[model samples]
Target: MNLPLHPLHLKEGGHVVDFHGFALPVRFSSILEESAAVRERSGLFDISHMGHFEIRGSDVVQAVNRLISSDLERVPSNKALYGHILTEEGGVVDDIMAYRFGEERVDLIVNASNRDIDRKWIEDRLPSGVRLADHSDGHVGMALQGPMSPRVIGKILPSLVDMGRREARTLSWKGGQFLVSRTGYTGEDGWELFGPSSEGFTLYSEILESGKAAGILLPAGLGARDLLRLEAGYPLYGQELTLDVTPFDARLDFAVSRSKGAFVGKEAILDASGKPIRHEGHPALTGFFVEGRGIPRTDCPIENGSGAVVGKVTSGGYSPRVGGGFGLGFVDPAFDREFRSGVSGKVRIHGQALPISFRPWPFVTGGILRAASV
Candidate 1:
């Protein structure tokens, strides 16, 4: 696997790990330490391995709008949208964040592992007068996330302080152009920056220095990023979502706009909604809190009180901020109803049954999200 680290990452002593064919930093400090830093202050992340695509031409908006579940008509120019690209059968191809640059140009940020498939998917379905171009190789992306993100980022890009969530702007600095978006995977107020790949290190260093001067920034890695997002009740691709799961099944109906007229998966989505399919033989996906010491891993079986197999865990771990282990996974919706209503169940980890209970997500509350709005 090719290791693509931002120059500043090397300088900071990033410990790189192979993640789905891309070498990414597991942590600069320890995962727990980095996680604490973000909760208390801010953190920087190098996310250049993610993919980017440009869609342009006369009918770009109309063409692009038909491709995703979000109501793109409502997404104003210079604003970003969080939604999914669905297959013809209504299953999710990938969940992406699309930024509308203008009437004729739009930018898409997709998951790293799905880059090739997503590019080809958009290219094959492009309407007349619309063209799709892959620019992931030419751009490097990074995120500044946490409660203090806006304050630190404002030092470099003051205009960012007033930008609303999902807003974006193209700014110039040192003879280079960057498309900065007030968006991030973490449930914190932050921004995602995009610019030339060759200058990734220089830009990263400058941001790091600026953050250090502010005394609220820290270098975070994938570990902290995952936990923060999960705590926010955000769903991750390949875990809470998959090509086999429709947007409706994942409780993402908000993304599907029936008034948008015809999309690729319109028929399937409409039909499925009228008579949703229930996973009779499958376990339902739900949130659970572990009562004992055990970290649930992917494919960990979940059993009901009668010891019947109900579902399997998708993502799980001890949340440093939450002080307990929690997980998200699919189980039979029948079991889900029972569990949610107080029926007890157990998560099978290492061949041992660990007691579990259904818990509401966004386990932590009253943070920067409230303050940022104020």
Candidate 2:
């Protein structure tokens, strides 16, 4: 897939890589530099590759409520809600954010990789009178994040500078209008903007020019984004979440609404006892920090005292903010009970079971300048 920002990335000397088939920037300078920019100052990311879909009609609200696990009853107009889509068997199809505009119109931004599966799953169950449209081709998306993000946005969209978290508002620049939401995947003060694909290049340049004087905003890419989300304890679709992993296993209970009544997979997700099942391995994704001088990688075996494999690392990296190597892995919740200060286990690194410790997934709290995406 081609990105609207590809030409700009090349002009800026970004190192591009194939991420889930789309060629995009991995970094403009260094991963550490870009990641630091978002944490301490500000950064802009091109996330145009994510899938965009919309549902509309008088009954769209009701149709959406039945499709996802979250209760949208209180999701006020011009705000967004995060939730899950499940198979009848209770496994996750995709995690999504529903942006509500009115009683009838709603836009969904889902993971880019789950484009076909998520659209098909939702459309198949869409009720009569509701309409679904894939808007991925019509728009380009960008994320502006960090403590200085609000200041940068103020220069471009002064009206949106005061917009509350999770809220959406329309803004126009250069005769091109679009939606800007106070939402983001990174654990920072950020906003996601969706506008005409034709205006993408101009928007990127404008933001750069607007914030360059203050050294607050810099172009960032996937490498920095991955680390920032991991630091925030957010789950990546293909990593912590998968078709085989339910929201329960992902520790995303806050997104599920049992009291909202029926939704897809409500039955299979709950046991006869009316609770989310832990399924095989009793796996639950949790965060961890390296005990000493070890780095963890994906698929690294997590083991107990008896050296039995209990879980595997999902995402791990050096956390520049924490000044330590950190990781996220799925482990038996029962093992979590064994924590004194932290859960000690053997993390198979480089063919050796290096001793490791498991703590809560979010290594840092309140680091995000704004409210979390969900």
Candidate 3:
């Protein structure tokens, strides 16, 4: 479970932690410092623990499209599309990114923790003309993120700079071809690159050295990455998304292709969206900022002006950019509008109810210079 970049991270003073059975860095210097570095400049992350799969066959697009919520045929060649693999009941199995190379080939990047689950699910469903290849163990994934990412990445791989957002290309680096995508999880203008495991050390070292020459890049870890994604209002698999949560409940309607004919869970999803089952008060995801001294945490109760519990925090943390604690949580559909417009919302942190304000997310964009364009 040791990553290809494990030694490099250790040499860079990373604080190692066990994450989903993989040994990964929790922080390189400090979480706060790393967060700031990404916002102000750039940060490099080792994301090799993620699963990579390749589907190749004459009917690859049609075969893969039947399993996910998004329509692969609609995606332009060499572009990536984000969607979820749903269960029959319309609950999320996993959120994934699918990169289409052509009608005959497609690539997928799935969460590290769900590698086996996703593989098994996909393998069992693939039709006769298509085949799936698991390259998770043989590949290394790396990300260069933030405002200065373009500059830093350009120093190492100049060809990647011209790619538009969500664009993917198989380009040569040191005489070897690898996949590079103008995509990232940190809500920054960045690129996620994948190459052979054997080239991991060299690739990481070269990028690190290039970043150092610019004096604007830092080695970041999971803590900062989590915070960045949270600020961006992106959902995490185990947090905002789960087997029990549907895309409708998570407010990810955009990831679902309602027009894309019969996909897995299509009927259930349409039923859910059309006539939502109001379990747990019929929750809907929303963002909030704590207005008092206390920081919010997961499971904290959110109450209305009349003191009725309307929602519960799913992810919460302090962000200096926000000037205090911020969170994303699920609330009753009836109160979604009131909470979104900053009316009558309060979150109980510890034993006290703290006033809160609501806002749309990608909460802070000042540091996302390059991302702004995309």
Candidate 4:
């Protein structure tokens, strides 16, 4: 389960751990240290474990649009779109990023854990004239993120320096074309690089060398990646998203094409939107800032002032930007409504009802976002 860049990580002193069947780095130095480097400078991550599927043929756009919640028809060439593949019951099969090459080709990046299932799902639903090919094993994925990412990449791939957000381009490298997308999960100015697995070592080494020349690049791992995404208030597949959770529950309605025609789970999503379906009540994913000293963890109960259990934590951890323990959880719709209106609540951490406050999304935004920093 080693990635093509596995040797490079070990050489950089990365501590390896089993993550979704792949032996990936958990940390190179320290989570806090690596995360700080990414925010201030640059960090590179080995994301080759993710699934890569190439879908081609004249019906590529129409075929994928029928399977995902987002409308691929609206996406222009050389752009990337994020969407979810759902079941008929509105359960999420997987969250994916689709890179459109043109009208005839689209590349899908799916979760590592759900790779097999997602491939089968797409394969079974695709009609004639659409061809699906699994290139996961033959591809290498890396993400270079932070403020200095553009500078580092500019040194190696100068053509991508000016790529706009959510844009993708395939440039010739070593007689082969590699895909580079201006997208990332860390809520920073970043780019994702994907190319032949055989070239992974060379590509990673070149980026590392460029980063070292800039005097700022760090080799980050899953630990830093998790914390960074948490700080950005972004959701992980198995954590904030799951088969039991709908796009509505995770507050990812923007990914759904509401104006589009029929799609899988469209009816179910419409029915579940704003409806109380869960046991305690329908839930909405919300961010929390723990005022107390303890860090929040998964399954911890989120309670109201009246001592009623309203929700449970899905993903929780310490964030340097938040300056304290912060988490994302699904709370009862009623409780979420109250909190959005300025009512504070409590999260029970090991029997202690610590004071908790609502924190707006994209908890830390600056580098790429030109708006007011939160």
Candidate 5:
């Protein structure tokens, strides 16, 4: 397959690896080193493959609010929202980031693999006057994430540093203009930049060079990105979230605005919220820390005290910062109490049972300095 490369991939001797059909860098340096760098200092990521769309019309906000679970009415221009586009039955279509451009315009950032599906879904539900345009092809995106990301990038791009979390502004840098948002997937203070593809390459080079001079930033790869996001308690699309699962099941009720009026999945979601919690039929997403070696991989069966299958692992890996294995997976809530009572459930990995215990999300802390200040 012909793999597509992000602009940054062209600059950093990025060893291209096929990731879900897109050519992405597995690592610019070593995965372990890059992973450690982001946890300790800062790292830059090339995420241009993510999809972008422009929505415009008098009814754009209304149309968008109807399509997503987030409350868009209070979302000011140049601010972004993290939420999900849900099916009429309340199942998640995709986890997305929405940016309000103006009263009549908005932009949507969606997962790369679901780009076409997301665009089509948004268009199908748009009111008659609304217009939806796919801009993924023309724009490029990148993220600078970690504890030192804000200060480092701020020194190079002063305007971006001043922008608070979820805030965005159009600024000029390296002889070009770009839209920079103070946001990231990794639980840290950082910025995500979007602009013309050519200028994106220039900005990527400049940022990398600037970070190099600062000696605190490095080019991070997908491996580091996964570990950082996991530690931060951020869910991955296909893993922690999926079409078979509703936002409520993922413990993302905050994203669903009950007072925002009717949306595509409003009725179903509201009904689900009102019903008594069921401990069976569906699995509850929970966090777990491993007791021994051998990282848990996806589809690893989770068994209860009596050796009965309660659920299965969805995402798991070692936390370099915590120095142990941690993971998120679906488990029967009925047995949740048992696991809480020291029942000692085990995760089946590679034909061996690895003892596990439940742990809370956000295995890492202290990065919410900006949000806390607010």
Candidate 6:
């Protein structure tokens, strides 16, 4: 469960923790400071614990297209597509990124916690002539994220800085193969590097040290990442998304390809279609902010002033960007719609119902969606 960057993190004063079986840095400095570094400039993050699976063969594209929910026909080579791997019943198995390397090969980046399960799920359905390889253990991953991330990365890998959004390229570094993809979890322009462990460590160290003179690129951790993603309105796997929740419930409809024809979970998802069919009285995910001193935490019941349980907080915390409490949770569709229009709701803490309201979306945005930010 030890990450390839474990030693490097220790050497750089990262406060490490046991996150989903792997030793991960919770914060390099304070979470707020690290987050500010990303907002204002850039930050480096170690995400090696995430799973990477390579599928190659003549029918690779067809196999991947049939298994995942996104329309891959349009995603050209050297590009990445974000989508969900779902169960037949329309439940999300895991949200993953598929890096298309033409019609013959693909690389899927999946969540660390669901690595084995996803691999098993995917491999079980592989057709003849297609190959599956769990290359996660052999490589390390790092993210350089922020608005000025390109400027910072330009110092070392100038060519990769302009690879365009969701695009990927390969390079040879220190006698090892390195892949740089313009992809990230935080809603910002960034690059994700995947390569041999030693090379990855070198890349991380070089970027942090070299970028210091130009722009501040701090070493970020899980704490800042969570807050940034929340502010970006991005859903976490175990939180807003789960095996019990369909894409409709999670508001991940964009990733679901209804026109792509016959993929896993398509039938049930079409039937569910924002209803409570899956969870039976289900609540769709929504964003909210707490006023004053109240900070909502996961599993806290959300009510509508009449003392009736509408939903529960899935991810909640203080946002440095919001300068107040901000979190995401699932609530009844009607209640969510009402609160989204600026109407107030209540979050039950202990026995007190503190007033709260839905905070539209992309709480703070400097993401690929420039129009949304504007």
Off by over 4 Å in 3: 175-177, 271-281, 366-374
**Residue-level lDDT tens digits of model 5 in 297-335:** 888999986788999988888876756888888888777
Model 2: lowest-lDDT 10 consecutive positions: 365-374
- Model 4 earns a TM-score of 0.94
How do the candidates rank by lDDT, highest first?
A: 4, 3, 6, 2, 5, 1
Q: Is candidate 3 or 6 superior in TM-score? A: 6
- Report model 2's TM-score to 2 decimal places: 0.94
- For residue 88, model 3's alpha carbon misses the true position, in angstroms, by 1.4
- Report the number of the highest-lDDT candidate: 4
Residue 339 CA error for candidate 2 (Å)? 4.4
Q: Residue by residue across 210-306, what tens digits does model 1's lDDT show? A: 9988789988888888877777667888988888777767666666775666677777667544444443343345888898899988789989997
Residue 304 local lDDT, model 6: 82
What TM-score, over all chains together, does every model reach? 0.93, 0.94, 0.93, 0.94, 0.92, 0.94
lDDT of 2 by residue, 1-374 (tens): 77888888888889999987888899999989998889888999998888888789998988888889888776888988999998887778888998888898888889988988888888889988999988787467899998899999888767788888899866686777676789998888888988778876688778877887777889999999998998888889888988887899888998888777788888878766668766775577777777777778888888887899888899988876756778888877787557424657777888877777656656666645333332
Worst 10 residues of 6 by lDDT: 365-374
* Tens digits of per-residue lDDT for model 3, 96-215: 999999779999999998999999999999998789988888578898888898899888777778889889987777765577899998888888988887776688889888897779
TM-score of 1: 0.93
Between candidates 2 and 3, name the one with more favorable lDDT: 3
The Cα local distance difference test for each model comes to 0.79, 0.82, 0.85, 0.87, 0.79, 0.84
lDDT of 5: 0.79
C-alpha positional error of residue 236 in candidate 1 after TM-score superposition, expressed in Å:
1.6
